[model samples]
Target: MTETAATNEQISATLVLPYLNHAVRMYEQKYASRADIDAAMRFGCGYPKGPLTVLDELGLDTVHDQLAARYAETGDNLHKPADLLTALVGEGRTGKSDGRGFYTYANGEVIADDETPSADDQPQLRHDIKKVGVVGTGTMASGIVQVFAQAGYDVVFVGRGEDKIAGVIGGITKGLDKLIEKGRSDEATKEAVLGRLTGATTREALADVDIVVEAIAEDLDLKLELFRDFDRIIKQGAILATTTSSLPITQLADATSRPESVIGMHFFNPATVMKLVEVVTAPATGADVNETTLALCAKVGKVAVSCADRSGFIVNALLFPYLNDACLLAESGVELSVIDDAIKAEAGFPMGPFQLLDVVGNDVSLAIQKELFAEFKEPGFAPAASLEKVVADGHLGRKTKKGFHDYS
Candidate 1:
């Protein structure tokens, strides 16, 4: 191999080690099935392959040894190879080379094995939710409103003012009009969806909806206050959910009178397009509530993966740390473009870490990194100084037209 190509491979392998370790940790914790975990990264983040699939290609034995060495060198628990990885290596499920690892392979490719339990295996969906009340009018909330309305549920969306509410409806209409122009939808479908939507300015209007989903900001105090209001105004058995990407769900659940009814339905940005929904269950969340939430995800045409109420749920928890590490790698004197190019070329990631950080906004990235660090107390999870410096300089990525790279 050329010197540059060999260097790219080395950087790619170093970058993937922590990410693969976290995937194994998530698996051992039963956050989601192997298939679902793979699907989440693929569908949610647009990864060419899931972490486990990449692990399989790398060989379980090789990764275990690398991780063991890294852990010994750094003395960080995050680098310690997961027990699952060790056990797999011990059993000789080395990787695709041996036709086994995190998955079975045949003819030099995965054999399409699915371990996700079918709906039939789950407890029967307990709630009958015909109406969904969404409390926000931002991009995420608007997308969620459109999703539920298109799925035939009456969606009551509340905003701070009539202008924000009008803006949301107008944006949805424009999107549908574009789809109509492209032959993907028609005027009739648009009208039908619009007819199911109700815009309001107050939380009291959501009193009768079967479920209320708040797609508001990530401020803990704001969300807690909203949950308290939801408890008082909403009907007895209606479910209360949050679309928080990082804050603990159990704390939000505790703010409500019916903690059992509060769960998390974390949808990715552009909720209308993304398919993965992390169905987070708090400690007090009932089994029926989780099943009902999973059923709701299916009804809305989303793939639901269950995870415990934690700092980052599944996707963000696994995603941000890798991004943070990339920042550290850059601090170690590697060019940002080089690291980005190497990861994209060698690992099939849709965006390199710096590119993704810019797109996500460095400020938001720093905040999420802080949440992960605070939750796990892992030294490796700390937000990189490079990321913090950019945010502090007000170069919050694409929005500010400057970050690690100048967008202007």
Candidate 2:
């Protein structure tokens, strides 16, 4: 397509139009709404327009027919028309030209009102996740506790001692306070979220919960012990989950007698902030448990993606390799500023790789990279020497007040 381009317009369209098609296909798959998909791409990747919005302006029928014909002729999966697109075309609602598409079009413009996919159309939930118990007092634990409480679920957060439990509550309060200051939440909402939180220092308190999520360290043995304990304490049909981002879900599930009830609910850091939650299912995990976990994710306002029980799941699996390469680039005497700036300006990434590493914690990044290397044994995937040194020097990132860029 770019072969004889005489101007930037042709090349830019050639690069962008395919992705715009992809975005439309993704909305059809129910990954997210046209508005959210667009918002995320615009804010997260710095795209000028969300793919679906572009498709809406360009016309959905044009994209659908092109993709459908290409798929039939070339047998390329990438060119396949989305089912939703096909249905819209069959119904003669092509796009802006005809006043209908992914968005309701009127006079060549769309109504600005946003819509959430109606929950009434959702799949039948297998089991309810009404109340949840979280075990730990760390940032992730407290973050997850806040996520549940904010979603109106009664949360019993377990910690070892009175002071530690107080600290966890204090952490949740401080986070909510920051949210309020930013106008992301309000005083009444904070009170209601806090009111839903109950503290416990033992597993005994989790006995009445519908689900228990362990948010402790990433050690396999410790997680095994916790799962075993949860198996013994929580009720017969309750679900068990781990927030381990890089560890193997199968190993944790095997530690419990009821492997079918065990699954992975890998919430991103500062659980209340990040939208993604990898809902992983081990081979032995029950269908009901998987469905319940996914339903709970929607209830708690997180976008969930199902994945197999594997190291790093999806996001970390793809993210760390790039971060590792950035470390190698910096260590090879390339100026970090040049790399960060060039990638941001040219690639349109919201944050350069080093900035992401700092936010993710070099220690955590290195840990995840090591997990990846151990599983895949790819020499390129090995942790960069610079990453190790930064971790060893105690400059983990924002949490430590220093990293690839100084935060202090």
Candidate 3:
């Protein structure tokens, strides 16, 4: 290595010590699980791994020197290494070379033998998909249409009425225009995307499509009814998917005669922007169907995680509970601003809970809470009375101009 490059590496190694020491101390205190700590570092701080994992990777001696220097400078408990870390460093059982430390690395890379295998290992999907059908014309539906069309797939956007279909096209155009104004897309790309998008006021438009994504309202009966109608028209072997966040995939599958072809392709809000897609499989769903859906998500530049048909799946299952807790905190007489500030300052959340609630819309929160509480009946899942009152008052959120805090 050049002298300057080697010197920079040395400097980085020295600087990492205090951070590693703090991580080790936090781990010893049992403040959070190793996996969670690692996730926080990766998500919150944009680090490759948690502090302990990095120390293990960089060598304990290197981390120790940095921590010792930090301790000399600050004399704080945070700079002190945990007993477990100290003992490991003392014995020189440093990372990859020793086949030990926080994780076992084979050939200097962490092995995934014990880690959960991803769904991507099965097979690459055949992207012979020339056409796709997206039902519903809401914000999410428009976003999905934009995503598919932008990827060069002929997309049919279906809604109940001609006016609604036109509105969806307008929404897509507005979104694309915003992208152009921001210099994210060229005029040709925008025209190409719009060219691939077609709006229809009937399910008949989906007849020639290879994949059908239902982005209808989050009503199980309405979705099941649509699936029943769709099954009668859609071509055989076509993959049936839903964007439902809370409904059971099995219930939607039961609406169709070919349950084996049905699956859940849940996308987050502003579908065009989010990277994660939950590819849910019902009990009767065929392996090929799941494989194809996952492949489609990847083709559209999304990360897919396959999961069993369950309420909330992965992200929502863990996230909503935390949000529910925040609601309860606000309902317990804490000032909305104070509750938000406390969580943001103490927990490092990007937005305070109340602000997030306002942004997500109280009506959406109430609906999700009702579904969760009905299924699990956990006391923690209980909906906040304040939230109920806000929705009842029609102060939904930004769309309604008022919620926990008034926009006017």
Error of 1 at 62 (Å): 2.3
- Where in model 1 is the C-alpha error above 4 Å? 1-6, 69-76, 105-119, 122-124
What TM-score does model 1 achieve against the real structure? 0.94
TM-score of each: 0.94, 0.71, 0.73
lDDT (Cα atoms) of all candidates against the true structure = 0.89, 0.76, 0.74
> Model 1: per-residue lDDT, tens digit, 1-408?
223444787778667899999999999888777877888888789998899988998889989999999899878788899999999999999999999888888999677557535656764569989889999999999999999998999999999999998998998998889889999999999999999989999989999999999999889999999999999999989999999988888999999879999999999889999998888899999898998998889888988888888787778888999999888878877888999999999988999999999999999999999989998898899899999999999999999999888989
- In order of TM-score, best first, we have 1, 3, 2
TM-score for candidate 3 = 0.73
Q: After superposition, how far is residue 34 of candidate 3 from its true place, in Å?
A: 12
Highest TM-score: give the candidate number.
Answer: 1
Better of 2 and 3 by TM-score: 3
Note the residue pairs that clash in candidate 2.
none
The stretch of ten residues in a row with the least summed lDDT in candidate 3 is 1-10
Candidate 2 lDDT over residue span 31-79, tens digit each: 4556656655553334466667767666778777766675687563445
